[model samples]
Target: MGIKNRLKIMSFLQYFIWGSWLVTLGSYMINTLGFTGIEVGMVYSTKGIAAVIMPSLIGIVADKWIPANRLYIILHLICAGALYYAASVSDPTIMFWVLLVNAMAFMPTIALSNTISYTCLEKNNFDTVTSFPPIRVFGTIGFILAMWAISLFRFELSNMQLYIAAGASLVLALYSLTMPLVPTAKKKKNQNWVSMLGLDAFVLFKKPQMALFFVFAMLLGAVLQITNTFGNPFLHDFASNPAYTDSFVVKYPSILLSVSQIAEVAFILAIPFFLKKFGIKKVMLISMLAWTLRFGLFAFGDPSPFGFVLLMLSMIVYGCAFDFFNISGSIYIEKEVSSDIRASAQGLFMTMVNGVGAYVGSIASGKVVDYFTVDGMKDWQTIWLLFAAYAMLLGILFFFTFRYKHEPEKLANVGVKH
Candidate 1:
């Protein structure tokens, strides 16, 4: 297959694994397994926990011993097995470890997928900056398809959902064996084992601007997981109430939430325009500010169409809030870094937000939700309001603490240095 065809298949299967679970796992956790808030948090935070070490570890293996394609296959095969084990297991704590292993393999693949595609593109002298986004955006389409499947098929409540992810992963794992081999980077004779493995991205801390950006990346990452980890269960919590049981929000929550993906598709086009118009710093601040509204709007919105309107609008804003920072930040990293460490820098970036931030936020949010929603009362309003406040506080602090002067012409293309 051509690079384009390979990327198309990779994008489809790459997100298929995640789409099987991410949106509806909250509902499954709350309504099915009957796990406690902390346990649920820990389980959901598997992605975060794995984020800390998995990508970097895999980066080393890919660089030194194995080709990226081979490591990619290994990760997915491991993920498939672990996810299947999770489906068979009953204990939440055990499932934590199971899912943790799943995440350990799965999360790194996000970075690895990029590496594979970028490698192929670079070989053909294709521009990663422009070519990659349009191709990669299809991953979001896969994600949307997975969500719709989960809801339409009533897989959210099934233990078999994990199996669905595993099956897709199994397909991806096998498919990878047939894909073009991404050559492993040859190690330098004097390269420190750690540095060769991409640990050098850690030295980004030596620069104050770099340090500030990462810290804020972790903070913003906290907001990113809030909706994914809890919003479904929070909205579905109303189903437990007699009055809202028949509501559209409760009946078709995944479909309702899928609007965010639709919004994401539309907003991605606006990012270049926004970046040029407002610059990265302001665009991100706009995102954080929007997140503040996101949670707060949910806290007050009801099960009725009017309330559901607020929920829908929040989903719409989610595109702007999420895509702007993630893609723009990735581009910013590409712009600011040396060409050599750029891939590792991207990996570390994912590690911070999807990794460390995810772990902390999911567990913390769970504990808070458990505390407020005690005695059979699901105090989702209070829970959302707290998150809104957190977003607001982070936005305020980020505005004063991080300083970057954007040059519009510089923002237009990737790999262009000022």
Candidate 2:
């Protein structure tokens, strides 16, 4: 009925569309479609590929021509069609193109959703710093719900997940038409090609501290994609072992994976205190260490007893590994970059983490998995340990290279402002 509620719905469906397919799509491809590791990685890498180009181009179109909300609706309509087609594809090549189209239509909407929400909230005189986080929390809830629905309904390895995502995309498309309109920005006479394309954000690289932060952001981005691409399949692979065949972890991997999302929500709430107490640099180091634990725990974890505890620990630490870098990094970038290129700078950050970084992570992770597979059986423990070693190496490098003194006063007022 109100603006906040409308924004909440938008946030919910925005992530729900992604959650329906993202976490379990690898499992579906691996178990049902019989796609190889490389094939599955190629499919998922479409998001990264699309993210590199589409979001900035779409942002320009939204700024100069279409209103954000209207463009948002249009993208969802196209995404709905793409997802429907993706559900019917049998060939990996065809599926790659289909998902790439879907990613192109869907990836830009994430930024558009935030733009729409910020505009509507400010227009209604709501303090976004205080109001937006609570509304955005619903997005994570929506993601978890989608995962639960797919798992509980036994659709985790079925094309039905894509259909569900397509249906939700269509619903969101229609619902978005009723949202508050966001006007496009008027064209400026002196704008250059770089500024128009949001490439002006690249200027942040001129600063040493900002440059280091983004480099590590890209590295961590790669780390993030590794789990998303393999975690479900890894769990499902446990069925090969007799002792774990009937275990709850194997039976309901998505529900178990949803623990990571739940942990994400809890960690997000604690970010403000962590920021005020530790500042960005230490918070980032903590995230790096958490990432090490996240992968290391998985290296020895199983579906039962003590090993299950390790698995649970991995899920819980995922929150810290993810939020401490991503959410906090965004906040840090906001503080570091100039406001004039702020939007573009944010776009650059996403491009690094979600675009190029994700692409590299997916492809490399696929190669690693394939390398560890002998006689069609994957050595998951070795694979996970290698990842853990990578994370630990990154932590050591970051500790020595990144230098930022704590400034609690600067962030004392920074409590989930995004």
Candidate 3:
């Protein structure tokens, strides 16, 4: 097979494995396994924790010691083992640790997938800017297909989802081995250990705006895993409400949530326009406003078709909520920072958003849920409202802190960032 075909298959499988369970795991945890909010949050946060530290480390090793393709295969193999073990678990405590192991192996691969793609495309002399997003969108398509497969196969609420994930992961792992090898090019003779490690991204914290951007990035990062933790189960919970059982939203919860991924693709296409017109700060403010609406919509949505529509709108808004801030802000940082530290700065943002931000959101949300528990009922509305309020407050803060005015010439000159 040609390199492009190999990469396309690998990309498809990368997200297909994740989509098999990512959107529906909360439902499985709560509706099937009866795990509480905290446990569910922790399960989701494992992704964040993995997102925090591993991507950069893996990137460094890929840039230094190991070939990206080789590392990618190794991580997937490790992930396969942990995922199989996780699927067989009956206990939450053991499940947490097992999930953590799977998370570490899998999380870094997301970024690594990007690295591999860029390297392959560059090696083959393809224009990444014009060509890559279309290819990347296939990953989202694969993700949606996997979600449908899991739900349709009735694997959504079972350990079978993990089996599905493991199968896809193994395919990805094995397929990755056949892809063109991306060997680390020695950058400089006797590279400094710290420089080689890409630890320099930490220096971005010195700038006041960088610090604030990351702080809010972490704060908003709280929202990152919330839907993944409760969204499907939230709709499934309507099954208990009688009025919502026959509802399309309840019956087709995964499809309802899949709209978010659909919206993500749309939002991504709109980004260049939005960035050119509004600048990153305003665009991020838009993200905060969009997020405030996302959770708030869920608090009031139902399981019926109309409810599903409302949920779909919530999903549609998710594109703006996610793509605007994360992708756009990274580009903004890339425009401002030097190339040598650029990779590290991107890693730092991921650490803040996925790591510290995710940790805070999960732990805090868990506490909020536990506190709201009374007589075996969770105050779901209150929890969502609190989140919405927090996002609103964050929007207000970001508006004041991040100062930028759109200059078309400058934006046109702006380069591609991670």
> What is the lDDT for 57 in model 2?
71
Off by over 4 Å in 3: 1-8, 26-42, 120-130, 178-185, 189-193, 304-308, 330-343, 405-418
Compared to the true structure, candidate 3 yields what TM-score?
0.86
User: Which residue runs does candidate 1 get wrong by more than 4 Å?
Assistant: 26-38, 189-198, 408-418
Q: Report the candidate with higher lDDT, 2 versus 3.
A: 2
lDDT score, candidate 2, position 253 = 83
Candidate 3 lDDT at 343 equals 41
Predicted model with the maximum TM-score: 1
What order do candidates take by TM-score, descending?
1, 2, 3
Q: Which ten residues in a row have the lowest lDDT in candidate 2?
A: 409-418
lDDT of 2 by residue, 1-418 (tens): 9999989999999999999999888778888999987798788879999988877677666666678789899999999999998898878999999999999999888767766776687678665444656677778889999988888898978999999999999999999989977876655789888667656667678878889988998899899989888888789899999999999998888888899988988887777778778888888889988988998899999988999999999999998899888877766765565444434555667777888789888878889999999998999999999999998898899889988988766553332232
* C-alpha lDDT values of all predictions: 0.80, 0.83, 0.75
Give the top-scoring candidate (lDDT): 2
List the candidates' TM-scores in order.
0.90, 0.89, 0.86
What RMSD does each model have against the real structure?
2.6, 3.0, 3.3
